[model samples]
Target: MTPITRSTAQLYETDFVAWTEKTVQLIRAGQFEKNDKSELLLSGKSGNKRF
Candidate 1:
């Protein structure tokens, strides 16, 4: 069996704005499968807190 190698992206660290926009767009477009976080990583979830 061949092992699959996947490349990782650091969008959240490199460009947070772009990451947020992309995440929002994916949600609005109903592309849930494309979202990195299954729950959308909303505030209070995935360790994200609102300040």
Candidate 2:
């Protein structure tokens, strides 16, 4: 298997502002849960789940 690289991992880590913007967009688009409970339940373990 190919070894993981720092650049590859770093690409997945977005800055705070970018992350916040994307999350807001998703919420507004109705792509994410509307309620806190539903959101928590649907949240992923890591960034991988978000993708």
TM-scores across all candidates?
0.47, 0.37
What are the per-model numbers of colliding residue pairs?
0, 0
Q: Which candidate number maximizes lDDT?
A: 1
- What ranges in model 2 sit over 4 Å off? 1-14, 33-51
lDDT of 2 by residue, 1-51 (tens): 998799866766656456667777877898865423322334456533322
Error of 2 at 2 (Å): 28
Candidate 1 per-residue C-alpha lDDT over 1-51 given as tens digits, one digit per residue, 9 for 90 to 100: 865444324543557678778988998999977888644544664687432
Give per-residue lDDT, candidate 2, residue 8. Answer: 67
Model 1: lDDT to the true structure: 0.67
Best by TM-score: 1
Task: Please give the CA lDDT of all the candidate structures.
Answer: 0.67, 0.58
| Each model's Cα RMSD | 8.5, 8.3
